[model samples]
Target chain A: MREVPVGEITKVVRDLFIDANINLGEDVLVAFHKALEAEESPTGREILDELLENAKIAKEEGMAICQDTGLAVVFIELGQDVHLVGGDLTEAINEGVRQGYQEGYLRKSACHPFTRKNTGDNTPAIVHLEIVPGDKIKVIAAPKGGGSENMSRVTMLTPAVGMEGAKDFVLQRVRESGANPCPPIIVGVGIGGTFEQAALIAKKALLRPIGSTNPDPELAAMEEDLLRRINNLGIGPMGYGGRITALAVHVNMIPCHIASLPVAVNIQCHAQRHKEKII
Target chain B: MAEAKRIKTPLTDDVVGELHIGDRLLITGVIYTGRDAAHKRLIELIDEGEELPFDIKGQIIYYVGPTPAKPGKPIGSAGPTTSGRMDTYSPKLIERGLKGMIGKGMRSQQVKDAMRKYKAIYLGATGGAAALLAKSIKKAEVIAYEDLGPEAIRRLEVEDFPVTVINDIYGGDLYEEGAAKYRRQ
Candidate 1:
């Protein structure tokens, strides 16, 4: 059994949060560069250029790529063979968020929902933990800003609505979203599972690298189709009417009840800030 | 369908009226920051027939909640937040002489109507470009609602703040026009 000290976990979480906030991951940067090349509309191309430039400035200046800095969401894959020493795991994660936001100068966006009061420090991270068989502890941090998150939707449709309905729903959401989510955006579609699970899966799908494809051939095809349709909307970059409204469309699916075809569309802006570390 | 035009800030009726959908703007001068909580409070003050926290006449409000500034910086990454949430309070603010807004997404018809009536304009900043956007803000000082933390109203001095005219005073909407132009036939 591998015993990881609680202090080490706290340090890892703090460093990961700070790194994720200030840095735009290389995969997302590469995707933006590719989008700039593929964008046919002059305005779309210009928007892509600005996005790339923004990433560069953020990296060079050690500033957050986006002001929202988003809610601190941590996904932990804990090994059953590992034991945590010292403090509670959840508290350690929250403390990391507090330290990172404070030290990194990242915005503290978490607030009391009804009162709309700031949480002062961005504490109480949204942590999702799962126990796996490995001896290593893996943590993934993704800061989801409000614009794209506001556009996220989950619906349980009758099985009769089928794949076409799902596609249409996603396309409609993206179309209506326009420049809000900061195109060229990423569309994460979660199909099947229960309603909540579908939403979770869609959010999780966004953590994957921008251009990676689903292993399943059918799902991959659907992703392609959705990507085409979304770009067809010509929302362009920043909705200035261009050909490249979306950089990618990713889908993650799981089995659901026969009567249900639950779907969730999770939108992510061009910033696409996420990072991972292992302890 | 008109060519894009670049404009500076501290906007006037003439500048706001000349703007059309899809026009690019590089704004300078003073702009303020406010969001949902601040908007609600500001409108409440207006409704009560009291003076606002700041002068709203002929001013632009950015829908943003910025990160804490690093030492020696005026502000941190301060990109615009989603605008639709501010739709409710915007028309009223426009009625009171608000000239422009910098944020993302579409607004309600009432807000559009108010824009036309009041000669106001709504500009869409590149959402999520906070760090990049922050470089343009030369100064930021909280003017009101300090209790709101990030949502506090801030008086900002800016230079070359980039934006696109999403809704012009003439009732042109870049969102609808842009989407229609790009929609598959």
Candidate 2:
């Protein structure tokens, strides 16, 4: 087995978290430009301009893109052939978050649910670890803000509803979300998984580049149809009203119990902050 | 949507009366900032019949919890958080003579009803455009709840801060109107 020092994991997490907050991903920027060209409403077009300018200033000044830098969400694919050494993996990850939030000057938004007390240093990152076949570890850090996250939802559907039911739920959520999630949002839907699995898969779908086609032809078509329908809702940028409400809709599907049809909708704002590294 | 009107802080009835939904405006002068945590504290003070940190009359409160300003900048990425979360507290504050609020998203009907009765208006700043919005804030100073970190209340001196009216005393709701205008299906 190849032994990998856990310190390296900490370092990777720290850098990825910081990088994700400061830099808006290239895919999101391209979507903004594309939306700007296609957007029809005057207010929608101007809001897109402001979003693009915000991205530029955040990059040039080395500042966190938004005040709500968000909770540090780490996804790790641990290889079966590798043995982690030197420290506890969970502790290493949390240390990285504490360091990143402090050094990056990003907001530490994690807090006690009832007391509403700040955790001080964004600690105890939501870490999702998966055992995989490779000898190398791959990690992704995505900072998810509260506004968009608050609007995401998960539900179990009867098999009778099928795709039509799924589509309706997705559309309703976006319509109700309106400006709350910060419009020009990305809608990630996970279908056919268990309760928690559906939510996880839906969130992972957001890690995919905006507007990229799904590998499965069936899923790809649904993604396109959903994207078109969501944008047609005309929530527009900042919900000021326009032709471009959503940047894209991405769907991920998996088989489940014959009786169950679980659906999850994960909404992502235009900031679209994420970074990945394999080591 | 004529040329953006110029608004100074500590708003009065004349200015509030003239502003309409969808009207763009550039606000200059001092405005105070607070979000959910600080707002809860302010409301508790009101419940106990204690004095607030700042006077409420004619003042505009911005719903934002900005990041710490790096050196050489007055504030870091200042942008509006979702306004719905403050619905519970806004009515009480609005009744106390608060004239305007800057935020993004739809407000509760209760908040709107209060706005209509209290002669206040809701404004929308481009959400997620924090880095750009920080440019308008010339200065920032935390005035209360320093322990709340980003959620602390701060006083900001700003110039030409851009926003659009979302709710007005005449009962205009921009979010509803804006969406209906664009909904094709």
Candidate 3:
């Protein structure tokens, strides 16, 4: 059995958080460049250009790409064969979040839900842990901002609503959201799971690289179809008139009870910020 | 297509009114920052017939809760937060002479209507570009609600702060208009 020191994990988490905030991921940057080129609307193209310029300024100046540094959401894939050594694992993660937000000058967004008071330090990360095969520990840091998160939705439909209903529901959510979630957004659809699981899967789907295809052929096709329909709604970049309202539509599916077809739509804005590390 | 123009911030009603939905604006001037908590207190003071920490007339209020500034910097990543949350308090401030709002996300119909009636405009700064946005803010000082921490009201001096005109005084909505134009038929 391998023993992993808690401090090591904390250090890694802290570094990853700082790095993710300062640098726009290459995949997201490349996707934005592609959007700029393929965007048919002059306004859309211009919006894309502004976004690119913002990114350049962010990188060059070592500034955050956008002001909403986001809530620290840590997804940990722990190996059954490995045991955490020395101090508490959860506390270590939270401490790391505090240090990272402080040192990096990232915003502390977490607050008491009812009081609406800022926590000062972006602490007590929303951690999702999974025990998987092998001895490798994988950590994915996804700093979720409030704008897109507030727009996320979940519904459990009767099996009879089927795929058509699912499609309509997803499109309707996006259309109703309009430019609020930040146009040219990425739609993450989670289908065929329990109520909460569906929501979680939908959010996890966003972690996928933009413009990448799902391995399943059927899921990939649905992604394409939904992407086409959402953009047709005419919510161009920043909701200014444009052909590229949505950058991509990603779907993740799981088996569900025969009586229910649960669905959740998680919207992610142009600043789809996430980073992962395997230790 | 119209050419993009660079305009100074602390934007006036005249300049804001001239902007359309899709116009890209490089803003400069004196802008203030406040979010939900600060807005509530400001409105409460106004309701109680008390003097505000700062005058609302002709001033642009950015809906933001900035990250704590690092040493030697005036402010941290100070980007816009969601605008919808400020829907309730905004119209009241507009009536008090508030001319502009900088934030992300959509405004309620009531807020949009208020913008039209008051000749104000809602500009959208990139939501997550906090660090980049900080570069534009040359100076910041907490003017009110210091107890609210990051949600405190701050008086700011900005230079070429970037924003897009999401809602205009002429009942024009960039979100609706832009989406309609490029939406696949």
Candidate 4:
């Protein structure tokens, strides 16, 4: 059995949180440049320029790209043969998040839902774990901001609505969201499976880099078609109206029960902060 | 929507009236910061007829919940949050003489009507441009709701803070106007 120390996990999670919050990924930067070339609105182009400049400043200063800093979301894939030693796995993850937010000077945004009380430490990360075949663990950290998360939607469709209905629904969510999710946004679509599973995969779809295509030809075509249609909406950058409204539309689908046709749309801002570590 | 006009805060009816949708701006002077939590608390104070922590007359309240400052910096990444979140409380604040708002995103119809009626304006600062925005805020101090953490109200001194006029006193909206001009369908 491969043994992994919890302290090792803790240190990795802490560093990942800080790094992801500060650096705008290279794929997103390239997408911004491409969007800048395609965008028609002068203001939209200007906004894109400012976004690029902000990314540079954040990196140089070692500051967060956005003030929200976000709620910590960790996706973990653990090997069946691996043995976790030295501490509880979940607590170690939260401890790392606590130290990261405190030392990095990032904002502690998690709060009690009803009472609206601050969690203070930014602890209790939203952790998703999958047991895989190998012995190593792969952890992906994504800090999701409230604005884009607030715009995400999930609805079960009638079997009659079909794929076309799902596409239209995704478009509608983007249209309704407009500038709220911070346009030139990344759209993560989760299709099929049970209702909850659809939502989970929809978020996971965001972890894929901007230009990658789905292995399924049909789904790949859908992603391309959606990207074109969304940008055609003229929502522009930051909703001021332009040719490039969405940076990318990523769709992930699975076979659902015959009775179910569930879909979830998770919108991500241009910041697109996520990092992965494998051990 | 011609050239941008340089404007200082604590705006007046005369200056607010002259601004139009799509006009760019460089706002200078002092502004107050308030977001969801602080807005709720401020509205509560208004309903109770208790005094606000700061004077509301002719003041601009930026909708931001900044990250905590690192050493040697006055404020951390201090960009605008979604202004639509402030919609419910904004009109009431406008009614009480809040002159301008600096944030990103759309506003509710009620908030727009209040801006027109009250001779106020809404300015759009580029969203996600937090680090650059921080460079404009020369100073920041928590002025109220200290326990609210990032949501605490802050009084900020700003210099040449860049923004675009999205909603002007004359019922003009840049989001609608700018988008309509370039929309193909």
Candidate 5:
């Protein structure tokens, strides 16, 4: 067994969280420039311009791109052959978050659901862990903000609805979300799983780099079609109306029992803040 | 694109009357910041007939929860949050003559009706453009609810803060107008 110290995980998580908040990835930046050129609405184009400038300033000053700073959603892919040593993995991750938020001047967004009491330290990150074949550990920090997250939706359509139903559902969600999810948004569609699994993969789909395509030919075509229809909705950047409401549509599909066709649309704002590292 | 029109705070009925949906504005002067937590408390105070932390008449309230400022700055990255969350609270404030709201996203019909009734306007700031938005805020001080952390009500002094009219007192809706002009599907 290859022994890996948990402390290293803590450090990586801390730095990744801060970096993701402060920086905009190149893929997202490229997508922004493309949208800027294609956007026909004057206001929509202006909003895009401001967003580009915002990213540049955030990078130069090493400050967060948005004040929401977001709830830390960490994904851990642990190789089956690796043994974690030295400390509890979960605590170490939370410790990293606490330190990062304080040191980076990041906002603490997590809170009690009912009373709305602040957690103060931004602890207990929403962690998704998967075990794979190698001995290496991979970590991704995607800080999710409340505005876009609150607009996301999920529904279990009966199997009779099929592909057309799935497509319609995504369109309806995007239409209803309108300007609320911060358009030119990224639409992540998770299809053909159980209720909870659908939501999981839908969010997981967002981690894919923007302006990238799905490897599956069938899914890629669907993504292309959906992207076209969504932009046609006329809910341009910041919902001020234009031809480029959604920058990309990522679909992740897996087989499910014969009776269910669950779908979850995880909407991501323009910031699209995420950073990943393989150790 | 038209040149942005400059406007000052303490927006009165006459000043608000000249504005229309789709007009770009450079707002200079004071705006008080509040979000979900702070709005809830302000409503509670209204219901209880208690004094508000600041005068609401003819003032704009920005829906935001800003980050902590860096060592030399007055505030950190601050931008508009979604307005729908405050829909319920807004009508009550507008009933008391609040002039404008700065946020990102659609307002409820009830809120729209109140704006029409009260001559208030809803302005759209580019959502997620926090760092760029922060450049206009020259000063910020927590005026109330300090324990709410980011949700605290802050009095911000901004210069050339950019926004576009999403709704106006004359019943114009920029969001609807803009979308309808572009929808082909």
Candidate 6:
């Protein structure tokens, strides 16, 4: 069995958090540039230009791309042949989140939901783990902000509503969201799963690079269609209005009960911060 | 279309009235910062007949909770948070003569109505452009609710802070009007 030290996971997670916050991925940056070209509104084009500049400034100065450093969401794919030694895996991840947010000068956004008490450090990060076939561990760090997370929605539609219903639901969500989730957003659609699974996959879809299509031909077509319909809503950049409300729409699907068609729309703002490390 | 306007803080009804939906603004001067927790307390103080920590008359409130500053920096990335969350408290604050709000997103109908009635305005700053926005903020100091951390009330001095007038005193709304103008179908 391949042995991996748990402390190393902590260090990696910490660095990933800091890195993801300060750097805008090239894919997201390219999407912004493309949107800038397609956007019809002069004000919307200006907003897109400013966003590109903002990304550059954040990277150059080692500052956060956005004030909301976000709730740390870590996805781990642990190889079955690997043995993790030294400490509990989950705590190591949280420790990394603690160090990253504290030392990186990132905001500690985790708080008591009801009482609104600050957790001091952004700890107890949301961790999702899966046992994979290989010997290497893959860690994905995604900092999810409250505004976009707040705009996400899930609804279980009747089987009769079918694929058209699913499309309409996502479109409605984006239209209703308007500028709230920060327009020029990315849409992640999870379809054909159980309720909870659908929501989880919808969020996971956000991690995919913009412009990447689904593996399945049919799903890929649906993604393209949804992307078109969403932009047609004219929510535009920061909702100033234009032809580029959504940068991309990604859909992931798994088998579900024949009687149900559960779907979730996880909205992500244009910042779309995520990074992955394999070890 | 009118040219983008340059304005200063302690915004007055006359200046706010001259603005319209879709007008770009370069706002300079002092603006107060608050978010969800701070807004709750501000309204609570108003309801309890306690004096607000900051003046409301002719002042602008920026709905933001900034990241912690690094050493040698006045503040960290500071961008506007979603404004809808403040809908319940904003009208109450507007009733007290709060002249303007800088945030991102669409406001509730009640807020639009209040803005019209009170002659206040709502400006939309670029969401997620925190780093760029921070450059405009020359100084930031926590004025109240220090325990709230990032949600603490801060008085910030800004120069050429960019924003678009989303809701103006004359019942104009950029979100609605702009969407209708550009929406296909």
Best by DockQ: 5
Q: On residues B1-185, what C-alpha lDDT tens digit does candidate 6 reach at each position?
A: 35678999898878988998889999999999999899999999999999999888999999999999999999999999999899999999999999999999878999999999999999999999999999999999999999999999999999999999998888988888888888986
The DockQ figures for the candidates are 0.70, 0.82, 0.66, 0.72, 0.86, 0.82
Candidate order by decreasing lDDT: 6, 5, 2, 4, 1, 3
Cα error, residue A268 of model 2, in Å, equals 0.4
lDDT of 1 by residue, A1-279 (tens): 989987887788888888888888888888888877877767667677777888888889888888888899999999999999898999999988889889888989888898777788887799889999988999998988888889889988888989999998999899888777888898998999997899989999898887887899999999999999888887888888888888888999999998899999999988887888888
Per-residue lDDT of model 5, residues A1-279, tens digit only: 899999999999999999999999999999999999999988889999999999999999888999989998999999999999999999989998998998898989889999999999898898999999999999999999988898888898989988999999999999999898889999999997788999999999999998787999999999999999999999899888899999999999999889888999999999899999998
Model 3, position A115: C-alpha lDDT score:
88
lDDT of 4 by residue, B92-124 (tens): 999999999999889999999999999999998
lDDT of 4 by residue, A215-253 (tens): 999999999999988887888988887898889999999
Report the C-alpha lDDT of model 2 over B32-134, residue by residue, as the tens digit.
9989888999999999999999998999999999887888888888899999999999999999999999999999999999999989999999988998999
TM (chain A) per model: 0.97, 0.99, 0.98, 0.99, 0.99, 0.99
Pairs of colliding residues, candidate 2: none
- Residues A118-235, model 6: lDDT tens digits: 8899988999999999899999999999999999999999989889999999999999999999889999999977999999999999999997878999999999998888888887
Model 6 root mean square deviation, Cα atoms: 1.0
Give lDDT tens digits, candidate 3, residues B8-91.
654577777678887877777888888888889888999999999988788899998887787888987777788888999999
Better-scoring candidate (DockQ), 2 or 4: 2
User: What fraction of correct interface contacts does each candidate retain?
Assistant: 0.81, 0.83, 0.73, 0.72, 0.81, 0.84
Q: List candidate 5 stretches off by more than 4 Å.
A: none
TM-scores of all predicted structures: 0.97, 0.98, 0.95, 0.98, 0.99, 0.99
Model 1 scores a TM of 0.97
Cα misplacement distance, residue A140 of candidate 1 (Å): 0.4
